[model samples]
Target: MPKVRVHNMTISLDGFSAGENQRIDAPFGDGVGWGDELHAWFVEASRDAAAGKTGTDVDYYVRGDENIGATIMGRNMFGPQRGPWQDESWKGWWGENPPYHHDVFVLTHHPRPKLEMDGGTTFHFTDDTPERVLERAFEAADGKDVRIGGGAAVVQQYLRAGLIDELHLVIAPLLIGRGERLLDNVAEGVEGYRVAEMVSSSSVTHVMLVRR
Candidate 1:
C-alpha cells in the first residue's frame, strides 16, 4: 500500500510553519522571507544532492523526492497570488523547471487550467477536500506514494483527518514570533503515531513519525 507522507517540512522553534503577511514579494511571509533560515538545511542538502554528494542527512532529505508520484499542496505553497487568478501569466514561483518532477495537486478555491511545466511537473488546481484530493493523488501515483508538500494549513487538514501515514518534520533553531503554526488546534493529533526516528544536525532536528 502506498503511504501518504509529509516529508522535510521545516517549522520554527515557536511552532510557526510560516511567517505572517504572505504576499507575492514575500512567499514565506514578512518575517521569514521564503524560510531562508528555516529551510537552509534542506536547501544545502538539495544542493549537495545536485552535486552528486551523498550522506546520511543529505540522503534523508533528498530521498523524499524519490518514488513520489504525486503531491498535494495548498494554494499558498504554490504561490502568493490569491483570489480568482488575477493574471494567467503567473505560472509559479519556480521558473521554467520546478523541483517537483511529478503531478502536483494544488488546493484552491478558484479553478484554473492544468499547467504543464518543464521537468515533467504539472500543476492541477482543485477545490476538493483533502480526502478527495488524496484519492486523486493516489490514483495518479500508480502504486507510488503520495506526498503532502504543504504550507501548514493543508498538512493540518490532512493530519486532523488521520490521512497521513508518515510525517518527517525538520525543526529549525530559529523562532518566528507570529505566523501560521503547524500543530495548532489539533490536540492529540498524533495519538496513534509515534516517533520512529530522530536525528539532529547542527542547524536542524529531523523527527520522523510513523503510524502504529
Candidate 2:
C-alpha cells in the first residue's frame, strides 16, 4: 500500500502556515516571518541525520524511509502564482537542482510540458484532479509511499478527500496572525487524528499524525 504523507509542514502559533502577501521574493513570508524557524529545522535535521547524529528526528523521518518513491505538490508549492499561469518560465525557486531527486508530479489547472532538472528530478504538471495525481504518483512510487507537498489548500483538498494517511507538522514559535492557516476549514469533515509521535526541539515542535 502507498501511504500519503506530508512531511515537515511548518505552522505558526496562530495557525498560519505562511505570512501575508506571499511573493516570489518572500516565499515563506518576509524576513524570518514564518518559515524561517522551520527552514532552520530542516537544515539542522539534515545535518544531524546525515552525520549519523541523533538530535532531531526530522531528518530521520524525512529521509529514514528511502521507500518514498514519488511526490505530488500544488502549483503554488511549485511556484508563486495566483490565478492562471501564463508562462512556464518559472522553473521553481530551487534553481537547477531541487531537493527532490526523484519523480515529482505537480497539480495545476493549467498544463505545461514536463520539466527535467539536474539530478533524477522531473516535474510533471497535471490538470487532472487530486485522485488522478495520486494514482500517477502511486504508480511512480512503485509500491512505496507517496509524499504530498503542499501550499496548504492542496493539502486540505487531499485531506478532505480522505487520501492522506499521515501528516507531520512542525510548529514554529512565531505567529503570523493573518496569513493562510493550514487547518482553516479542513478539520470540519475530518473525523479525527491521533498523535503518533511528538518531539520538542529548541526551534520547533515536530508532531506526527495518523488518521483515525
Task: Indicate which candidate wins on TM-score.
Answer: 1
Candidate 1 on 12-118: residue-level lDDT in tens? 98898888888888788877865389888888888888899987568788868878999999998888787898887888888989988889999999979999999
lDDT value, candidate 1, whole model:
0.88
Can you give the lDDT of residue 126 in candidate 1? 95
Candidate 2 C-alpha lDDT tens digits along 107-160? 888888999999888999888989988999999888999998887888898888
Task: Score residue 121 of candidate 2 by CA lDDT.
Answer: 87
Q: What are the Cα lDDT values of the candidates?
A: 0.88, 0.80
Worst 10 residues of 1 by lDDT: 26-35
lDDT of 1 at 26: 79
**Cα error, candidate 1, residue 144 (Å):** 0.1
